[model samples]
Target: MMVMVLMIASYSVGSIKVEAAEELDLQAESAIIVDAKTGKVLYEKQSDLKLPPASMTKMMTEYLVLEAISEGKIDWDTTTQVGDYAYGISADPVFSGIGLIQDKDYTVRELYEGMAIISDNATTITLAELVAGSESEFVKMMNDKAEEMGLPEYKFVNSTGLSNEDLGENYPEGTEPNADNLLSARSAALLAYHLINDYPEVLDYSSTMMSELDDQPLQNLNWMLPWEDNNFVPFHFEGVDGLKTGWTQEAGYCFTGTAKQGDRRLITVVMKTDSKEERFNQTKKLMEYGFSQFETTELFEAGYQIQDESTLSVEKGKEEQVELETSEAMEAMVKTGEEDLYELTYEINENNLNENGALTAPVEAGQVVGEAVLQYKGDNDYGYIGGIGTEQRVDLVTTTGVEKSNWFMLTMGAIGNFFSNIFTTVSDAVKGLFS
Candidate 1:
């Protein structure tokens, strides 16, 4: 049968399709957990609701900075003098600043470390200005990058996650002065997915639990991470690392956290939680569920062929049929013991067939003749993030070449069929007359 299929080439065996675990009933207003490698959403609660991101918005700023460095637009040692706008914000003890001096040239590396490790408001502004010449222009870049990355719901008003009102007349131009940066949980998880996949070096900064800035100690806002001398004790999970945290009277407590445990990395977001401690506690619930319930399972090996539909009929070829197999192995992160819920279906390329539904002779080995789609027979099949890619389906290819039949053999077969038909017709006529 002819069929259409969706492909998620960047994901493993398409999206994880298995029975939904007991609902987490996450406490946050919006929350989502995604597989970092495949961009699959393991769990979501009101994930599409747009809400103020608070300092979590800095993750985009961090992404833009790393992109600039990789593109040769800036270097770690490249320095820019702090402007009065940034210097003014640094002097405020309430906004989480490391105290920058006016017009002091600071390296990109230093500013980046401050912004990432501590969610320093002034350092974020400085880095944005350095990369885009002004915070207003940088805001434009942030919005542009969000669209480029296929983030479905997002709005960037400033490089820092702080509301524009807090900027005190320094907010980016062309934006409402009272507006706050907003993003949906799904989009935040997607941004984190792209950030780590595109610039993994970011973890080097976000993973730091403590850093020193000009003899002043700056602690990461993400308390789930381990400290220099020991784990954070009560909150620290074994693989807890990167990401960013945010808070404001308007945004409450928000966190975009990522962790890796034995080759499997997960990214979680919790927004509008009641308290700082609650955010981490909610994150721990999501992380524990993912690690304990799901596992990377190989559904099919490379060269796997369908049981009854292993070959396609060939017309005028030495061999009557051509064997087919999958192009590659199929793997997925499915609930343990629920792997059998997946079923494979394939559709042959009708364009490659003749009126008689047989392939033309001279079929080349490894030629893709059709597609094999993997379907999930389970509930709560949250699809892959970004909803783009070709990994969801496998290409069905020929296993060996099929040569055309020689003219002599073709002629002989036709002659034999003609006589056999004539003999059978006469015998049937005589039998009918006798009866």
Candidate 2:
């Protein structure tokens, strides 16, 4: 028999399967939380509202630079000379510079770390120029990449998410002037998904809390990394590691963050928050809510015995029945209180079997007589259901062969054995008589 388990996780607007304690009150102007593995939106509010991403836009810079290194277009050891524009602001504290020096070269690795760890605008712009010849051209690359990743709403006028106010909007005629990096919370989350999924090595830089460049302490503005008590962190939540943070007079405070607890990893975004503290506090709350309301569940496990209802009828086999069992574990993430594992709908695939009623007599143990589909109720996309949640594949394993049985079969079997058993006895008896 073949069984596919589709689990529709419990979470409802009216008595949702994974309902919040109450309507979660959030301070951010727009926010969203997603499962990194599945891309399921655990919670979202005004997710599609267009907003400035601020320094979080650097995720794209990080992505482009990393991809360039991966494709052999550049290497970590390759050095780039800081442009005059980057050098001028490299030490501008207001713009978050890493003190890049003009005419001086820094390797791709060093620039990447400076940008990702300290949110340094100068290093990021320098790397962008290295990859695309200029920051404006790099902005085009960022937009092009976003489009390929299916993020239509992501528009990058510059490498940094800084608003137009931060950098004067007017530019010399014919020059591509800077604009705010506008992306919806949803779009930001999707960008994060692509960045992490495509270039996981990005976490190495984004996860750092404190580091230095030539002994100058480069402190991370993101405070939720370790979730421990310290003066550096105003709010603490366990399992958060990476992404980026952003702020501007027009953009306010924003964060694209990731956290992992056990097997569950989440990506969350908050936009246009009132203050630095509110963003962290809200992010912590969002992570806490996710961990509290949902759970990762094993829909089916290896060696799991099929219930009586899951068994199937066999045909033309010695065995009257066969059982559908899982040879490997199948798991999913569901709401906290959700009890139903998954919906297992099964039918014996008849393409291979010559006859239907019971499995054909030649059936062998471990043979795939059927397949198992995984799904759930109410949600066709929950967990392994809609490609929106955790994944679990069912490896079907059949029991030992029940060798064919029939009157004609028995006669044929006996006749085939006559030469070895009956014929030998008859020959021995004749020899004895002749002697």
- Looking at model 1, the pairs that clash are 8-391, 8-392, 9-389, 9-390, 9-391
The residue-by-residue lDDT of candidate 2 on 1-435, one tens digit each, is 332332222223233455553477999999988888766666788877998888888988888988998999999999988877777667667875767667777888888888988888878878988998887788778888988777746678878766644556322122345556789888888889988888988887788777777567877778887735576456767787798999988789999989889999888899999998888988888888888887776655565654554455665556766666666765555665443635543445565455544465656777665555555554423222122323334656675556667878667766877767977898999999989
Candidate 1 wrong stretches, greater than 4 Å = 1-20, 228-231, 312-320, 347-362, 369-371, 388-391, 403-435
Write the residue-wise lDDT of candidate 1 on 324-390 in tens digits: 8889987777776667677666667788889987788988999888877666666777777786442
lDDT of 1 at 209: 73
Backbone Cα, N, C clashes tallied per candidate: 5, 25
Candidate 1 residue 360 C-alpha distance from true site, Å: 5.5
lDDT over C-alpha atoms for residue 182 of model 1: 92
Q: Candidates' TM-scores? A: 0.84, 0.72
Q: Each model's C-alpha lDDT?
A: 0.85, 0.73
Q: Give the TM-score of candidate 2.
A: 0.72
Per-candidate alpha-carbon RMSD to the true structure = 5.8, 10.6
